[model samples]
Target: MVQPNPPVLEVSGLSMHFTSGRGKKKTTLKAVDQVSFSIGHAETFGLVGESGCGKTTCGRTIIRLYNPTAGKIMVKGRDLSGKLNKEERRFLTDNVAMIFQDPIESLNPRMTIEEIVGEGLTVKGKMNRAEVRRRVYETLDKVGLTQEHATRYPHEFSGGQRQRVGIARALINQPSLIIADEPVSALDVSIQAQVINLLNDLKRDLGLSILFIAHDLSVVKYFSDKIGVMYFGKMVELAEGEELYKNPMHPYTRSLLSAVPRPNPLTERFRVRVNYDPEAEHDYTSEQPRMAQLSPGHFVWCSPSEQQRYESMMRQ
Candidate 1:
């Protein structure tokens, strides 16, 4: 059998920390701690966790929005670490783009939708005025927005429509990797499905790779091929979406799945409650936690005792 190609984006030992104060009073907050994962070409990889668990930070760091304090971020075999020449930075920008959660805030209120979508092309000097307009119109049509809507301000559109504009802007660059950070979290339940379907359609139509970050496991399960569960500042579980949902490895993952509201009332009644003390502080002063492969294509981070207990439980 022929082996598969390597992933389009590979992140290894990625870590991000924030240092505050000075002298003996200096303190460090590990926003993203030793995370590693890969996204195949055209794959939808989902990262799910609570609000403050560093999901957004990880996504931002991968795109170089936040310069990672440590580790490697490889895009199509090129490591984005050292300062790149002007042209190289431009190339990276064109290859990877992000779609933020709030479309209203993400889109400049001053700019028309056409200008917003065409901004990337304008910056890259990729096309003249006529060509830019033509391309922008085409992209708008692709995202289910009319050419007329292009002239309207972001505030004029509904939440879903504005998000479509955001998607259009990201897609206009024709990026290989699009990091969608909680793209549907803000939309109404009815509109959320529409946006999710639109994203799925775009992935198929454009042959795009997406790193979808969200806190909802059900949505992530529907959109992702593989899922990585984050807790605090670490990835506690990584596995195929279906497998992870059926058999969660980490305690955190299990707790999350247990809380998913099932459609069946009977099953929903049996849902387990996960308790985490928000007021309690975590002690991270010891040796750094390391992730270990628990099975083929599945990984988890746990103490030696916890790992042994997990293994014994699985064997039972």
Candidate 2:
């Protein structure tokens, strides 16, 4: 899951470990390791990486779906890292919502749009059936659907429409922070634009903070004010979107950016893809590596020597 935009929340040394097998065969996997970043109150923070980099895992961990092995998850001065009490649980449920990746899989085919979108209100028992129905229609309309569409099932809608339904469900709670996991990946190019535009409009009108996780650099750059690039459960680079694109410091980030196809035919032809093999890139034998600031709002995971080198490179 993602954040609202600015320092309303902070995650310090967050880690999630999964252990499997028995005895000698037992092994532990650190899906997220010492990952730390703060998200603002009403802005979009784009998280990008190749598959299996712990983007989704980190989000899930923050949302408390999986217990963290170690670290602190703080929101609005409340430490939410460990087990949550009833009040903390209520706070989490009220302020945060997630729109999952698969449009079809995320929604229950048996349930109508009204049922799915109004579930939050119904669960809290704060509204009657008529009120829930009215709120559901209003929420649905916010995402580009109409009151008449509320009775339709998931099977009755297109992929884009289904995604919009998912959005409405998340919005019905009037959440401050939304963790949208690859929300547009399953749709066609045209539909992706529509959904993204809807999100932008909603963000502007409602002042929402979003944690947007996706593989599309173009979309991430366009929609996010800040971007963090993750690699192998670590955030390799993070900065404002413009700074990240203007000057990517980390080798892995450079490698990732090199792969993005430029629109200009001349530049695209000349673009050199940087192949980043982590083992070959750096030697952590003599020194341990950690996240270090090369400049304000620009950070890189590096050892002391590497930080010096990066500082030198920036100067050059």
TM-score of each: 0.93, 0.96
Residue 130 CA displacement from its true place in model 1, Å: 0.8
What lDDT score belongs to each candidate, Candidate 1 first? 0.87, 0.90
- C-alpha RMSD values across all candidates: 3.1, 2.7
The candidate scoring highest on lDDT is: 2
Residue lDDT tens for model 2, 189-226 = 99999999999999999988899999899999999988
**How many clashes (backbone atoms < 3 Å, residues ≥3 apart in a chain or on different chains) does model 1 have?**
0
